[model samples]
Structures are given as C-alpha cells and as structure tokens.
Target: MIGEQGDGESVGTSAGNKRCRNKQQAGKDVAVQGTNDSSIVSKCSMASLGYFNDGFLKGFVNKTTRRAPLINRGYYVRAKAVDYSLHCFLQKTASYSQRQILSLGAGFDSLYFRLKASGELENVIVYEVDFPDVVQRKATLIKNKQEFMELIGCMNEIKPAQMDNLYLCGLDYKLLGIDMTEIVDLDNLLMETGLNPACPTLLLSEVVLTYMRDASSSAVIHWAANRFSSAIFVVYEQIRPDDPFGQVMQQHFTHLNSTLHALTQFPGKEAQRKRFLSEGWEECHCIDMNEFYTGFIPEQEKRRIEMLEPFDEYEEWHLKCSHYLILSASKGDLKTCLSFHPPPDFHAIKLDTFDPLWICVSPCEIESENPLLRRFAHCSSLIAPNIVLISGGFGSRAGHHGRLRGATLMTKSGPVWKCSFVGNEGSIHLLTERMFHSMTSFCDSCCVIFGGRTSPLKPVTSVLLLKCEVGDGTISSISLSVKEIECIGTAPSPRWRHTATEVIYKGQRYLFIYGGRSPKEMVLNDWHFLNLEDYSWADIPVIGPTPESRHSHSACSWKGGVLIAGGLGATQIPLASVFHLRPTQSGFFWNRIEVTGSFIPRYSHTAHILDDKLFLLGGVTIYSDSIPEVTLIDLKTGQSLDYHINTNLVKWPVMLHNHSSVLLVKERQVLVVGGGGNCFSFGTHLNHQPVLLQLPEIK
Candidate 1:
C-alpha cells in the first residue's frame, strides 16, 4: 500500500508505455474501490503505520495501526530525511524575514499540522496541493477533528469551507485542489492564494513525480524553478529500477496498479542530479539511503534505533537502502542551506538516544630549548609530580654513551615542553653507557634504575638511585647516587629489557623485578625484590603456572601486585598473552588473564595505569611495522578496546617501540619520548623526537 501511487489525468501514451500506464491506472482504481480513497492517500496511511511502529510518532496516530518491521524502518528513514532537510532549509534561511513551504501532491501528510504544533510555522506560509477528491477527504477529516484544527489556530472558529472543490485557508496555512498535469490551473491557484516569488521557498515532493507522465512532471519542475527566486527542491523516491531488489519493488507497485513512470526515466542519483541541473537549477546533491544512513544520520541515534527491533536481514537491508535516495536542488542563495552535520537542536527530536563516546588525540606544542636527539630503547620515570627523568638509550648522538636529562612538564604555560637539565649539569650520571633498561619511581624524591646492556654481549647488574628536587619552575638539580644493597639471598642475574615496578607491601615500600633476557641472551622468568627501607635484595619464589620467559615486555603496579603484558616470547615472536602476579605469604602467585577483543601482539611498547585501567601505547607488532594505537584494557573485566590517534591533526611518530611514556595524571595526557624511526633494520638507523598525546576523559 505504501509503495503504490494514484492515477492522474491521462496523457497521450505511446505503444511502448501503454502497458505501464494502464496497469498503474487499473491498480489505482482497485485501491480506491477497496479502501474508498486514492491509492496515494492509502500510501500515506501506510507511512503513518510505519511511523507509529518505529516510535517516531506516538499517541499522535491511532494505536491499532501496524506495519511490518522492515516497512517501519523504511518509513522512519524517509521521515528522518524529510524532517532534517526542512530544518536545514529553515536554519540556512533564518536571516530571511519571509519564507514559504510548498508541498506538491501532499495527501494526508501531517507535516504542516506537526510543524504548526511545534511552533516551527511562525512567520512562515505553507501550501499543500493535491487532487480534488483527495483534498476534499483530507479537509473533511481536519474539519471534524478539533485537535487538527487547533494546530492551525482554527479551533472553535466559524469559517466557510468548500467541500466540492476542497479549498481551506487558515493562519499561515492553505490547502488547495489542482490536477498536477494542468500547469495553468496550478499556477493560477498559487497566484490567487497570494504566492510571493521573492520569498525564500522550500519545495517537497515524496514519491509523487513517478505517478505522472514524464512531460507533466518536467513542466511542474520548470514552473517551480521559474516562480521562486531563492529556493531548494527536495525529492525522495526509488532508484535502481533494473536491479533485482528494484525489480521486485517495481513488481509490487505494478501488482497494486500503481505506475512508477518517472523512475524508469530517472532511475538513479546521477539521473536525478542531471534532472535538476537541466531544469535550470544552479546546484544539486543526490545521495542514496545507504549513504544517508552511514554518513548523515547521527551515529548516536542510529545505534539507539538499531536496538528497537530485531533485525537479521542485513544483506537485504543494505540492498533495500541502496535502492532509495534523497535529491536536493537549489538556486540563488539556497546553496549553503543544506549541511549534513547535525545542528545543536538535532537531539531534541530523538527520544531515548545517547551521545556516542569518542576518543581522539591531537598534538601539543613543545617549547624545549633544543630538539630531542633521535634515539630508541630509552627509559623514563616520573621524578616529581611534573618532572620526568630520561636516561641512556641507543642514539646517533656523540657522547660518552651514558646520558641523563630532565624534562619539566609545563602547566600554565599552555602546552609547552622544556628541557630542564641534561649531561653533567645534573647532579648524577649513569655509571656506564647502557640501553634496554628499566626505571621506576621509588618515592616523591627518588627513582631506581635497574639492569641494562652496555653492548650486545655486555649486561650490568648495577642499580643507581636518582635524587631530584623541583626548583625555579624546573627540575633545577638532580643528584645521581649508587645504592649499595646488601644481599640476604641470591640476587637476580644480569639482565636487560626487564620490568621494575615500585609497590607497597605491609605499609612498606619495595621494588619488584620480573622477566627479561639474561646476559647469556636466554629469556628468564625469575622474580626478585628489594626492600627500600634497608636496600636489601631477596629472591622471591614463584608459584602456579609460570608465564613464558620473555624480554622487552611491559609491566605496571596494580592492586598491590604486578600486571605484565606483551613481549618477545619464544623464537623472538611478540606475545599477546597477559599475566598477573599477586604477592603471597610464601612467594608470589601467577595467573594468566583471559582477554577479549582483537588484541595486537606487540613488544617494546609502554603501559601505564590510569583510573585503574591499563593503557598500552605505541609499539611494534608482528602484523604492522609500528603501531600508533592506544589500547585500553579493563583490569577488572579484561575487556579491551583499541583507538588510533588522529594523525590528520598531529603528525604520527615514525616508530612507537623502544619509547618512553609517562602519564601526566592531572592533565590526562601522555608524554612519549624518543624512540626508533621508520626502518626496523638496525643497519638503517633513524630516531624520533618526543610528542605529547592528549587522552580523552574516560567517563
């Protein structure tokens, strides 16, 4: 019933077009006899059935009316597109003091009444034209319903209404009857009803043109184009008439004796655009329903409506949506009136919808005196609340090999980066040149640096302590001190690429070291701890199923334990598994975490705990060269989601692995320091500078 069209004044038909015209006319006659109204009027009722089913219209229409779910979705999409276009037209022309809306072949369309009730009809004139019979029935319905009359401010008012020819007029509203094929009479009626040519106008035609002969439809379009100085014409109709789905759709209307004459001529968006352009319109835009759903519809509202029905016909739905389209043509100042971006008031029309959560990262300005030298495998730790200490790593810089520097995080200076201290100017320096090391903040003033490799075959077990103080709005001074720890038991062997985390146990501070490659290049899964109170080392026995020996892994303190994720496993392949370690009275217990989502196996990445969630940033993966991905893992549920940084606004780092990341908790940003460049081969060396990545608020 919804897809059916009504019969219009007969035109000279060629032998080739006789079958279609006769079938359509016969279907209209059958529909009128069956329902006591024109097929087009019943089609409007079918649309109302869909609106009520999809929750777009509630209590405004009869509750007993019902339609199929697919039909409802189709009608809902039509309603949304029409409403959005009207609002966009109005907003674009808000500066114009006078505006008008003309609805061609409008039959039982509650748009005027709805807009009037919503107070959107203020200072605007609306006109609807249809056949004499259709207009008389609609006028009678409006006259009998006080609720409908009240919308146009005609309630309880004595007014002369002609039922034979069907002419009604109210404040800012008019309904008239005219045969669309007769352009002379249509033009005369519009002129008699005080149509103004200078006013901005919006013309709407939904599934109306296809019912008329080609010449008649073209004549109507030309008349409107010549009448309005500034105007936009919006039309929604079927497309792809020859395709499988479209063929079925044509058959449905044909069986109902409704002809789609215009569809055969303008069967697609390109043809529709061409129609407007040839008709003297300045500009035209045409998009199919699939594009409208994906690109124009608000994603938040799309998700909400998707949940309203049980839909499993995805392939069919896509095919069906692709067969329908909305076309707009504009002249004069109306070109800027149509914006796909949702306006601020768009949410007011959507019920039971929520805004989608979006995460984005943009670049921040850096104000350092000297650019950071290119490097990789470097380690960094927060020495103070707003100060970070960066130490030795592989680089192209000519130096004694070992280097230490301090980066002062700027607060009120507006996203600026500054180097506070470097080289011998700092109180302390590394004992030797090293890379692939670990640094962990011990307290508010001290940080501990652990094992690393001075060269491929050379690994050191030395532990250094850094004492720093914030002064003059910078890390003005740093004192490097060596810790002479007394060993009560066997200590861990010399290893590189290990993880060291500072944790609290029984109201006392301790440092935990786990899994890395030993000096022999063998991966080790041993565990050890150092008591900060006495600086004593002790071997900690591990229980339960032990994690695979790994190197270049990442770990962080969580809930008085340690959470380790991703590293080079057996055969030097990146691992995707996650493991948690909990302190036990006997030793430490290990548990493998079950995670869900498309987890990327990576190594040389960095991880930080924020708001009880583990955030994994920038790493080299097996599948990709260097990943600029930000992955959030829920510590409690093990649920994970991945988000990529918006590289359009900020230049992406050449490489993410072997980098240092420190979270600025107050600012909710991560400062990523030097790492590798594009090429992964050691023969081709390229190092990147530092970048500040802004994180969206989680809530």
Candidate 2:
C-alpha cells in the first residue's frame, strides 16, 4: 500500500515537470516564429525596391517597411542565392518525370506562388512544413488571397476547423503542420502526404534548423539523409560566431530568444560542410555570401542592383556577408548538384618563415573626459609637436548621438594625453558636420579641409581653411577658427573618401587631391593640383595611364610625390596595387610599383611614410581570417612584410577600418584614434579609447 502511494506521487511530479517544460518550449517556439515576420518584411522591402522579381512576397506582409540600403543588399544576396540553388536543382533533375521540394519550417513564404506564376512548377511539387499555429495562419492567408488561390489552383482543406494540422492540400503544393524534430511522426506524415522516397527531391531550410536544440537539429539532418534516395539539401544560416561581428549577430538572435545552435560547433563554411558529410550525406559544399555573390552572380546583375539605391556602407555589407553562409549537401544522383567555385581572390598565401614581426598595442590612458574620442571615419591631423586635432564624424555627446560639429585637440604631456573640445565659441558655426573628409596640416597653426559628405546623398563642396591660435593663458589647449576659401579654375567635383596630400611642384606647395566618390559618380580617378599660395587649380602637363579609380585608399606624400596604396576598386573588390605619382619638372606621372611579398588586398586603412617605408595600418579584407595587421612596404627595395598586432596587450576590440591613425615618428608609435563600424543589424560600435601601437624595426 505504501509503494502504490509513492508511485502515484511520482507520476504527479513527472506530470507537473512536463507541463512546465512544455510552457518554456512554447515560448521559445513563439519567439522563433516571430523571426519569420521580420524576415518576410525585409524580403518585401527588397522586392518592393525591385531588387528581385517577386510580386507574391508583397501578399505575405501586411505593411512593408523600407529597409536601409545595406539591409536591402543583404536580403538581395540571400534571396538570389536560395533561388539559384533551387533553379540549379531543378535543371539538374529536369529529365526526371517528377521532382519534389520540401521546405522545413517554412513560414509565410510565397515560393510556391512565385514558381507557379512563372510556370516553373510544371512537374514539381513543393511541401512546406512549419508549426501548427504558423501553418494554420498561412493557410488562412492563402485562402483569403485571390492571387495565391489562383496560383495554388483549388486546394482542399483537411479538417481546418478541428485543427487536424494537415492545413492545405493542392495538386502541386502541400502545407503541413508538422514538428520536424519528431522524425518518426514527421517521416510517416510526409509519406502519407505523397512524399516519394525515390523521387528527386530538394530540401530547403532558410534560417531554420539553427533555432532548434543541437541534437534535434542534427536529428533532422540525419533523418533527411535517410528518408530521401536522390535528394539535395540546401541550408542558409549564420556562421563564425566568435568574431566581433559574429558575436553581435549571435546576440541579436539570442535577444529574440531564437538562439543559433549550429554556430558553436560549425563555426565556418568548412565546418558546416563537414557536419553534413558526417550526417550520412554523400557530398557537401559550402560558401559564404561574399563568395556566392562574387563568384556565382553575374556582373551585369550586380550593376543593376547597385543602381537601385545610393549605398556607402560597404564595410557593414561585407561583414554581414562573411558572417552568413549557404550550404548544399547531396545524396545519390544529386551529388554534383552543388559544387564549390571560389572567386579569383579567395586563396590565401602560405608563409615560409616561422618568425613573424609583432607589434604591441595598448589603449591610451587619457587624463581628461574623452567623449570626443568616440567617433569613426573622422580626420586627425598632427598640427603641432605635441598636439593632434580631431574633427568631423558621426558620434555621441552627453547621451545625444549625431554628426559632430566641433573639433577636439589632444595635447600630450609626459605619458598622459588630455582632450579639450574646441567648440563654436564664436558667433557662427565654423566647422560643418561631416565624415570621411581630409584635413591636411600645412603648418603648426593652419590646415585645409577638403570634400566630405553629411550622408551618402549630400557631398560637401565648400573648402574650409582652419587656423589655430595659442593664447598665453594655457599651453594645454588651443583655439581654432575656420574660413571658407574659394579657388580659381575648374575645381574637382564634390567628393568624399578622397585623399589630399601635400605635394611640392617646383618648390611650390600644393594640395594634390585624387580619387574620391561623388553624389553623381561612383568613383573618380581624376587628380587636381591645388596651389596653396594662390588657392587656384593649376594645370600640369604630361602623365601616364591613371591608376584604377578607387576610394578609401591610403595616400601619403613621399619624396615630393604621393604614394597610393590599396583601396576598393570599381568592381567592389579590394585592390592590392600600389602607385606613385612621381613629380616631374613639367607634370606628374603614375608609376606602378611591384612589391615582392604576399600582400593582402585591403582598403579603409591609414598610411604613413616613415624612413623610406610605407606603413599600412588596419583595414578590411574579405578573404582574411583575422583583421588586417600593420604592413610595411619598402619604397626602395620593393619589398613588403606584415606585422601582427599583439592583441593580448590590448583591452578592447580594435576595429581598424574607418578609424584614423597618426604616425608618432619620435615615439615609434602609431596612435589609432577612432575606429569601429555599424556591426550589421547588431548595433554601431565605437572605440571607447585610442590605442598606441609600438612599431618594430624591419629587417
């Protein structure tokens, strides 16, 4: 009698625990379903802008929100990649009499309507499976839309009121409410719903599987491999969960309660490929969105998309691409359906030497409040011996964030630095709020500011001449005044992301401006000689072929000439070519230098010429596994060497691109002023403190 009483209590306890677990799982499932809403809205935005031809996506979302250009481009690539995979599978198995497409966790996707409207589903059947609630709602949406109804062509409702979960059934389309993790029941239901075990099938999972528990997701993969005879399984999801951008991406999903389960184990493309191959798949192929866009998409198509909107956030776009990837695993006859094709620049160099040059980096300990230091893409000029002037960028102050309108001067004393804001104490506003502008210091008290933009659409044209005056009252701070200067002759077009170097032509000082993007032009290669003495554009005669047009390139005045380093080219790829505009008696000529070493193609970095060597600091590269390092190129010997940063000495994440760096010649240090980027859907990250990188001597 006591044993029976104990058994009854145990059963009650187990029942209560099961109910609690079910409640938690239900909450997580609801969060996962919410991702579909946001994703479909982004798809609607992309389609509305004519990024892709999908008239049916509009029917899914109630209201379309216009996404930023960066987000639009991101969705564009994703849709294109998924569409390409489906088309490839169709074409590869066209000879077969029947083919099937099973989309796991499909939520409000209009794939069937799109393919049907295009007459591409002649012998193809699409099966969409999702949660019972999501499937029921999708069924209601389809039944209500006349367009979807016509495309689907007389679908039968299977016990709709009773919520049997079969939802909708049509000739070529089937929408079922089935839990994919319950492989046994899911397999039986799919078979009962006319899923052929021997037919050529294509399984599609977009941003699904990752939200499930790790074992559950793995079981789904294994079940798919075992259930199909000739099939191709395509997955689109996130990878690289440890990097700064990847961490932010993971956190974004985690905040939504839709954690990505695959990223921890399969952190990259290769790891993902291996995961499928080990899960009873014949062959697997994987590539990040960067490679897919460059290698698979045509140039004409890319150009057409580029013209859809004004975009300048290339760093965020590339980072987003690198974090997400698509994989295709095939079994039986569809083994060759997905083959990896790397882009031309996807290969990495194998270093022969064991010893690598290392640079120690440490954050600067400022002696005063450093709110002004929280900015990126701002210009920094060493105007005085111990003072550096910083001006113009999108930043935050006193909890208000916007484009900075004032200047800040950093004065170095012994080992500590103090920052004082040079505000608009005068009557009128002197400095215009901008980013990616150039400020060249000609003397201790004076500097000239050139073109930049308030946004990608508004480019600044007026040239500003700034003069700094030191009062006898304080040695730690200086006051600045700005004056607009007009130049005679044909001035360069309004542009930003260009370089203005101080070059001397026949003992006369001139600011040589070269290569920037304008509101009208994507990139400009034309150069102009600005005579500082008369403030006039001087005409120089005779020149070789101009270097490829680029912006975000690094240029430094060297040997009365200007040295141009790596930059993003017209093809949206980073350029590794280095050019020198050697000044001649009559004019300047372009001289391409061949540096002998494995150099990574990069852009958005700062360059400095010191001791006949060019130091390229902190940039973005698509194919690199880690962030770029300090690259030293010998001007005389035509040799290049890379030095890795000792990140152990640093306290914070060092985002080098879009940051300013100053060469401290005497201290043998490089002061990285401000750098970070809008980490693609995560948030904007700005460097909290400036870092000083101690340089080492090159052999």
Candidate 3:
C-alpha cells in the first residue's frame, strides 16, 4: 500500500540502515560483560538484544534484507499490548484520588512525556524505569532532540488540589553488575526515583516483555499487582503464528548478524503471547498488526509508508508482510477492560452537577492558599454539566520530576478534583478514566465503571455494585456488593483499556462487554451480559459484522441503544468512525454509523451521554498532543455534532486521562480527576502536575 502512495511505485526494498547496524555493534560492547561468573549468567539471558549481535555480518545481512519499518510486527504487537494495558489501567483507576505511573523498559518511549505537554496531568507522579544504558541513551536523545515533537511533553503549568512530580529512575537492570532478573524491584526503583505507590499506579512494558522468559515477565506483573491501590501492567509483543515474511526477514537478519534478542525464545510472535498469558498474567485481547494496517492505512498515507521500506537492496530479498495487534489486561477492575458510549453536550449545563477537570499543581505552588486548586492553571474534558467524564492525562513538574494522578466522583456540592494526594487515599472510588467513551448515569446516585483500559483479564462473571449512598451531601467510598462473583456460563476476560457501556433495558442494568484484550493480551469482540441483580455474567451472542477488537474507542448509551465513537482498535493504527448497537434480551444488535466530520481516532479521550446526546472532548489528534475538539452524538435522530473550540481560549486543554472528577453540588457538571500518559500517547511526556478546569459552557 505504501509503495503506491505518491509515485504509485511498487513496494520496493531498500538498503538496510548501516547506522542501525553499526549502533547494534556499538551495543555489543556491554554484551555479556564478565561472563566468567555463572551467577551473572543467571542474572539475565534477556541480554539477547546484545546476544543477537552474535554475528555482525549476519546482523547486517538481516538489516540489508529488510526495509526500515521491516514488519517489526512483533514490536508493534508488544507496543500495542503495553499501550492498551496501560490505557485500561488508567481508565479503571479514574476514580482514584491519586495515580502513579511506572514504565519499565522505557527505551526512548514517550507516552508519559506527551501527556504532560498537553497540561492534562494532575497530582500524578510518573517513574520511567529502564536499564542505565537505555535510560542514559533516552535522556541524551531527548535532550539532543529537545526541539522535536517527541520531546515536547505537557508543560507543568496547571496546579490541581494537590502536589506531585514526574519522577525518573535511571537504574541498570544488571544490578550488582548482574542480578539477571533484568527487572528491578519496583519498590526500590520507586524509592530511588522518589515516588510513592500508596496511590493507584500503572506499569508498562513494550518489546521488553517478549525478550524475557514468560515466568520472569509474570513475576514483575504479580509484584506490581500487590504494590498500589490499583495497579496495571501493560505488555507489548508480537503474536503472529506463521509469519512467512518474518522467516525471510529473520533469515536475512541471521545473515546480517543483528541482535535477534526479543526473538530469542519464541519461534514466532503469538507463541510469545500465548506463553506469557499461560505463565500467570491473564490473556485479555489480541489484534493482528496486518489486520490493523489494512483497515486503517486506506491504501494511502505515504510518509508513514516510507518509514517501513527496507534500506538494503529491496529487490534481492523477498519481503514478508506481517500484521500487529495490541492486547491489554489488568489485575482487577484496575484496567485492561472494554466499554461503549457517546459524550454529552455541554448545552445541558445545570447547577449542582459535577464537572471534572485537569491541571498540574506547580511544585513551587503546591502549598498555595487554595491547595484545592492553588496553582491550578488549566484543565481539559468537555465544558458541560450534563453527563460528565474525562480521560486520563499526563503532566510534568515545574522542573521535571514527579507524575500526576486522575480521579472522578459525584456529590451534592458539585464536581471536585484532588490530584495526587498519597496523603488521602479517598479518591479510589471514582474513575476519571475516559477521554473518549461516553458514560451514562442510570440514576442520580449511580456511576458505573465500564468499557475502558484495564482492558482485559478473566472476567469475574459478575457485576460489581458499589451501592453508592450519597450521604452528608458527598459520595462516600463505596463498598463492594459482593466479595466475589464467579461465572458458570460465558464471561469476558479481565480487560484493561477497552470500552464497556450500560444498556438500560426494562429498568435493569445490563453491562455489555466487548473489544478488549485477553489474559494473553489479544483484542476480542465477544459480548457478555452482566445482570446487576443476578450478579452474574452470561454470554449473549451479538449479531452483525462486529467491529474489530478495539480499545480506546468511545461508547455511550442514549435513545434506546449504544453509540461508539472513534478510538484505537488494538490495531497499529487508530480508527475514526461511529458504531451503534441496541441491546435486547438475547445479546447485542450491531449497526455501523458514520458521523459527518471525522473525529480523531484516539485513546484516553473522554465521552459522556445524556438525554439522547453524547459529548466528546480532547484526546490524541493527528498531532500526538491532544486537541480541544468537542463533539456530540444524538442517538434519537441518528446524527452527531462536532464542535471545534479554540483550546487556546481554555488556557490549557489536557487529555486528562485517569484524572479524578466529582459532580458539582446541585449542578449538571461531573468533576473529572487526574492521570498520566503512558508510552507518550498525549502531547506531554510526564504527568506530575495538578490543576482543575471549570469545563466551559458546552453549547
């Protein structure tokens, strides 16, 4: 498809990048250092990235044979998985008052940085963990490439009701000069980075996961699960079973002597995924990269295509085209899940509503007079009072250190936000996790957590009830209706970073699950019903061409059905379209609907639904940073509205994912909370600031 873009040329091969190969060689100096000690050997075989440098010539051959973007489908797979998983975790933790983030194997990754750039982070702390070499390399690269878009993170301007910073831990996985585990103990790492885990935290791993043994990787996740109030682990790696092109590419790589480190144990990608899930982490959802590219590329979109061309003599080698998919999963309702819906229009502004907002509290101003919003410079999320919600976001400190947190809640006093208050752990009950999916409140007292990141895992096969009792004018921490609910019939896997929406039929809460990762980290399109009263999960087969297994899509309930907005579909690329569904006694009835204008196909955006109306707010746009675009979907008339606002007018428009929110007292606004970006999804790179926004009057 790329070959025919501008010149309409065929997909031709090119000379492999000699620079990369040389760098790969340069990477070898640290390879297998001090091999004399077998204890060091036990420390880590994960050094395959260096080991693959076994034969320089072979590595070169592999490089020359493939193009630049040589279907590194495996990397994409892992990237998607990790991305989706983090998204899910942030979504699930939306209700938490404080949020913390950790990115393992954070090699040259920019998720956290971008969020901070957009001014969306609040009272959050992000700790980026990577090998000393990688950390140093990334630091240097970021500094050298400071002017580039990748380095531009959310400017820590807004101050929330609390104080936090984006923290970085540059440590060597090879501890004691060698402890082989590769992954540093998170607790120690956090301490080293000066971060706290008492709050909710999200963890991420990319191509790094496939490189380690399944057991080793799982150990990291298991440990993470027990660390914070709500923790999420996202992994990225390939999962293609029989990739023909991959074999040819590997053949050439073997010829070049490149470091085939990530490919060391697994013969192929899916094997790595399957193995990982079987090890301990639950398998949630999976997506094929090829399928992702095909659906989104549009047979055009050129420059992106050129990046993939093999540099070394394209004609001589046979190129195998591979696909990539992003799978996500999480430990509890923390993330790796799914949902559906549309945002509510701000036109219905009312008094006494909770309108969520995001901001970064400057460290210098953390102890300001109104710590509730002292340095609170700006915020994101649609400015409205109807159905309210905001997605997770990232922020940076005034000088670059801690991360931000996000939460959501409702009360008679009105919407309120508290960034990272590790001091008070009361923000865990609300979820400020959506920047895209629309939300619906079944009643004035109920706020249902559904379809979002925390994407996929083993579904509890039951509905969780908080039985919210808004006493004393404010909503109190909710207690679970049941200790645990098991499923005997069909159930959705535990998912993070997916969409979940409620279908209010016959005055009963029917939670529908779809488009999330599996325990093994693959995307899925299966729908299961959760009867709130019965407190059980039931497989209800849905009909129609199911949308691709996706995460980060916006879904809302209105008119007598559900509406889906644009979002990432676990494919390497995101999608911009709308889908609607009607729920019946049996299952879901799907129907595809396209809005007039193309909405940004993004993740970590917020959506809310009310009175047959859906509201959409800031999220990732063509520019990695979030854009302030307000959109509305009307289910009653089968139409949608798009509103392009001057974000500059709002001071700072943040994709405040995982931020917190509380309903404005006796108002129509829903207070959104805080969260940071992962793998650089938003504009900023860090999420350690706190601030709030009085969502503008949504018209």
Q: Which has the greatest lDDT? A: 2
Instruction: Pick the winner on TM-score between candidates 1 and 2.
Output: 2
In model 1, the Cα lDDT at residue 440 comes to 83
Clashing pairs in 1: 27-257, 367-417, 428-480
Candidate 1 weakest lDDT stretch, 10 residues = 344-353
lDDT of 1 by residue, 471-574 (tens): 54443343445443344556678988889987666666778888887645457777788887777875557687888888778899977788899987654446
Clashing pairs in 2: none
Count: clashes, candidate 1: 3
What is the overall TM-score of model 1 with all chains considered together? Answer: 0.46
- Give a tens-digit lDDT track for model 3, residues 69-173: 222332332334344455555566666666767666554444555455544345456666554554454444444554432334444442322222222222211
Indicate the residue-level lDDT of 501 in model 2. Answer: 95
For each candidate, what TM-score against the reference? 0.46, 0.93, 0.40
Better of 2 and 3 by TM-score: 2
Residue-level lDDT of model 2, residues 1-699, one tens digit each, is 221231123344566665766677789899999988888998999999999999998888788899988888998999999999989998898889999999999998888898999888879999999998889889888888888888888765543332475888898898999777777878877887788989999999999988987778888899999989999999999988865567668878898888897888878888888889889999998888888999999999988988899999887888899888888999999989877567776774432338977889898878975778988889999887778889898777778777888788887878888888877777217687888899998955778999999998998887989887766424444677788998999988899999999998899989999898987888888888899998999987648867999999999998888999999888888889999998898888889988888777888999998888889998887776555677889989989888878777665667788889888999988898988778866777788788999877765
**Local distance difference test, each candidate:** 0.66, 0.84, 0.41
Better-scoring candidate (lDDT), 2 or 3: 2
| Better candidate number, 1 or 3, judged by lDDT | 1
Q: Which portions of model 3 show Cα errors greater than 4 Å?
A: 1-463, 474-482, 486-488, 539-541, 584-588, 621-628, 634-653, 656-670, 679-699
